[model samples]
Target: MGSDNTDRNKPGIANFAALKTAIVNGEDQLVRELLSHEPMLDIEKSYLIDLAQLNKNHTIIKLLENISVKK
Candidate 1:
């Protein structure tokens, strides 16, 4: 995965809202890292792929695609 220094200010994902915020900002590494620690990641679906496609961020779209979310 590539590093994105754009998210230097946002430190952690305290809740689902923060996860959404990370998705909106196209924070791939952060999102992946956070999801690794988030137990609810699979239980709750994240619309990051849609957001990435909507924003035309191919990097994020690809990143999100690689993630396997089991419901």
Candidate 2:
């Protein structure tokens, strides 16, 4: 028998929403927690813009901009 372990647990809108909420709420710990689980997570490309627009998180926006420049 052959075992196929592909397409396992994947992130969806729920995960995105949760991470967004954590960021919006300024729960850095939670954000770190989620990132630990999803190492490939990209805040700038994800909800960073939306959240910054909504909550006026200038710090986060600046941080994201810095990250983008670095990349």
Poorest lDDT segment (10 consecutive residues) of candidate 2: 1-10
Among these predicted structures, which one has the highest lDDT? Answer: 1
Q: Tens digits of per-residue lDDT for model 2 on 1-71?
A: 12333333345555656767876887756655554322334544455657756777665555444433213
Model 2 lDDT, full chain set:
0.55
For model 1, the superposed segments whose C-alpha errors exceed 4 Å read 1-15, 37-46
Q: Rate the local accuracy (lDDT) of all candidates.
A: 0.62, 0.55
Candidate 2 contains a number of clashing pairs equal to 0
TM-score of 1: 0.51
- Candidate 1 least-lDDT 10 residues: 1-10
**Residue 34 displacement (Å), model 1:** 2.2
> Backbone clashes in each candidate structure, one number apiece?
0, 0
Candidate 2: misplaced stretches above 4 Å? 1-11, 36-46, 49-71
Q: TM-scores, in order shown?
A: 0.51, 0.44
How many clashing residue pairs, candidate 1? 0
